[model samples]
Target: MNLYQKLVEIRKDVINFSKDTESFGYKYVSGSQAIAKIREKMDDLGVLLVPEVKNTISSTYDYINAKGKECTDHIVSGEMSYKWINSDNPEETLIVPWQLYGAQDDISKAFGSGLTYSERYFILKFFQAPTDVDDPDSRDTSNRGKGNKKGLSEAQVKRGYALGFKAGYDKANVDKQILSKFNKKIQDLTKEEYEIVCNGYEKRGGK
Candidate 1:
């Protein structure tokens, strides 16, 4: 990749690693930003990304290629499998990867599917290129959840949990105990909130 392109990709890598991005009203993150986050982790082998949908970018899997909470059984199709295990507790939940079914050609094009495993497993630090915009800052200060400053809805959060589980994090291993504390957080929130937290507990790709 050229310097300009590499610079752009670096920006994407950082933003991608910044948050869990799975629960409750995830906000919009531009392609550039996502790329910045993706670049940061390219240096390490801890990441497991999916194949790209486009031939131009197919050879290398950027953040755009990974499936949110790898739900498909590797033997079944893409040679992939993911399940969230609580590092804090044994009460782990198996999340079936839920792809946002639509007219899109592949996983990257499909929004609302869920948080990609990469997004959940690490904290993405944006490169903060000289020209990058602070998207959150552009939103209305008074606005609560509907602006760019807003975040992924409750549904998205659940998808992230699934990805984390599938990636093998173990349910919130706070003190070496498996626990889905988010379940409690979602339990009193709303139906959408509840699904995001509890549904991931269900299995994906039959055992």
Candidate 2:
């Protein structure tokens, strides 16, 4: 079988990793847990997953908080290349590239966090691994009186709309074009419409 087919087979057998760590009142599967599972299967599949750190950039922003306290934000951006190698053929290989950004008060902390974050997502996506918990960023909309319309909360809709508008407005008033195509205002858009606009923004590399 080809590398891609082998990957699909592997994904079928993979199990959802348990969340063994908690922070900020949220539970998540740590990078260590995810990598350990992948490592256990790599030898049998004759595939080696390697991550190379390509580049890193750092920037600092100064601002004041609501209390008028001076603050600084240090952001670290990193690029990573993940490679899947077939040991038997040595000629069959797959590469996936990813970029991630992290921010913290300490410079070293920012870069360290970004690197770990990138590595975790790289492994997860490549292996199509499942997690026991939903993404923390996702909101539970069932109790919000809207009866979980299309599985999105009112807050999520608002946030997605705002992101879409930001992307469109910054790019030649594309927001109006998107709204016109949907024939609806931002607040009135359905979950699918909001997702479409948000996806368009992502396709345009608008973060």
Candidate 3:
């Protein structure tokens, strides 16, 4: 089979949805879990995926956490390209592009988190893995409670709104400010992006 045919098989074989990982009071699939499953399928199907980091930038900032403790955030922004090839016919290949941002207390952890987030999202999206939840774009509001098209978790949204409120901006103002500053809706902000906004708010509250 060619690359497309092999990829279709992988997609068919991969897991749809998993709640093996938990964070901020909700459960979701972890990177390790997703990678393990994908790797197994790829190996069996004679497919290889090679990832290259095209560019990256890093910085650090000091702030206070919600607990009033001083903290430093190490941040990284990066762009990546992944090449998908059929081992049976190495001449045929496909290139996929992705970007990621990571923030953490440690520099190494910041990059690590970004890489983990990138790999998980890249594979899941490339294969079009099912999440078992209703379409995020659907008007149904029932299963829409889990995740949104922007990739923000419900818990993250709640924490962001609460942090913004504590920082002196009400929900509407919070949304307006995020839109103006980040060029993204509050619900559309990436985890790292929202963390930066939240950290900024924490600093304001500290002052």
Candidate 4:
């Protein structure tokens, strides 16, 4: 079998790998999980998968915090490449390109996070793994009582909203001032508006 045929078989086998892990307001298979599964099958098929950072860019911003303390934020972006090699024919290889961005108070954290993020998605996209449903907090409206003062239950909305806010702020690089224009706390945002924010964040590669 050729590289493409082996890859198609691998995708069929692992595409439904359960997203048993959750964090950061999203559900996804971790890099370790995906890699383990992929490596296991690829080895049996006599194929190899390799990932490398092709290039990276880093930037720092200095700003004042709400408490008037000086703060520095570092952002790093990377171009990643994933290679599939056929053992039988050393010359046969396929490459997929991916991009990643991460920001943090520490420069090392920023780059580390960027690399992990890139690798995680690279596995998912390259093999077409399925992500589980949206976070439960974003989906369950059962607690939303009819004619309740708040359209959405506070408890149910809080987790999702917090996740969305952090993702928007961190990954999308959304400005707090833009959110302030909405004139309401995140939990108080109408369902429609809240979804819009979340969607925008994801569109900006928050996920």
User: Which candidate tops TM-score?
Assistant: 3
Runs off by more than 4 Å, candidate 2: 63-69, 139-207
Higher lDDT: candidate 1 or 4? 4
Better of 3 and 4 by lDDT: 3
Estimate the TM-score for candidate 1: 0.24
lDDT tens readout by residue for model 2, 1-207? 677776766666555667777764667667898778667677777877777776555655454543679877566554568888888777899988776556667988877877787778766666656652554444244234444444344344434433433343432244366567886555456656667776785555434
- Winner by lDDT between candidate 4 and candidate 2: 4
- The residue pairs in collision within model 4 are none
Roughly what TM-score does model 3 have, to 2 decimal places?
Answer: 0.64
Please give the lDDT score at residue 182 for candidate 4: 75
lDDT of 1 by residue, 36-110 (tens): 555344443223233222111111111222234423211001122333333333243333232221112343543
Off by over 4 Å in 1: 1-29, 32-127, 130-152, 168-207
Q: Looking at model 3, which ten-residue stretch has the lowest summed lDDT?
A: 134-143
Supply candidate 1's per-residue lDDT for 164. 38
Which residue runs of candidate 4 sit more than 4 Å off their true CA positions?
24-26, 62-70, 135-207
Q: How accurate is candidate 1 locally (lDDT)?
A: 0.33
Name the better of 3 and 4 by TM-score: 3
lDDT of 3: 0.70
Candidate 2 backbone collisions, by pair: none
Across 16-47, the per-residue lDDT of candidate 3 in tens digits comes to 65657764445556678888888888999999
Ranking by TM-score: 3, 4, 2, 1
Compare the candidates by lDDT and give the number of the best one: 3
**Reference-based TM-score of each model:** 0.24, 0.59, 0.64, 0.60
